[model samples]
Target: QQPVQSPQAVILREGEDAVINCSSSKALYSVHWYRQKHGEAPVFLMILLKGGEQKGHEKISASFNEKKQQSSLYLTASQLSYSGTYFCGTEMAGSARQLTFGSGTQLTVLP
Candidate 1:
């Protein structure tokens, strides 16, 4: 099943912080985060495994709670360049290369 992301959209000011959450009904093997800008392809951010790992990329970080089948993305000191549609991709156990993506969270960082 496709993962669900909360807050379909978010507006944040520069240097602010925001959190985006993703949850799945089924067990997951790994979770991937990506950000896509207008007219651009999604860029890989980071990935967290089932062991409940947390990953960080620049000012952004994410945590995966395997037991709860949920994940959260944290954006610290939000920047205008961070404005984009963020997506959470999930892979089921024993499933390779087949990633199911969440609806998406639109983040707008304003000055």
Candidate 2:
């Protein structure tokens, strides 16, 4: 049950902005976001809920659309720290906090 993330790669000059959308078909109990730097493990970013609860991370926000079974991640004023691969994971039925990740989206911030 892999969720889908759009753009695959978003190029942004410094101080610019972009949006990465994530969507899932399965009933999502929660959604998680992580960013991975080159040759490194992904760092936990944040999670959103089916009950309109949001937790984890800072300077990042996401929303869950129960009607569409989708979520969108908002990145404000792109920074160099935002440069990396962003992925969203969704929990499937009977799955306990398990995450199925999209292929990934490469985000590059230019100076």
Using lDDT as the measure, which candidate wins? Answer: 1
Instruction: Quote each prediction's TM-score.
Output: 0.97, 0.90
Clashes of each: 0, 0
lDDT of 1 by residue, 65-111 (tens): 99899999999999999999999999998887699999999999999
Worst 10 residues of 1 by lDDT: 90-99
Q: Which stretches of candidate 2 lie over 4 Å from their true place?
A: 54-57
Q: lDDT tens digits, residues 36-73, model 2?
A: 99999999888787875644345667787766778878
Q: Give the runs in model 1 whose Cα sits over 4 Å from its true position.
A: none
Q: Where's the lowest-lDDT run of ten residues in candidate 2?
A: 51-60
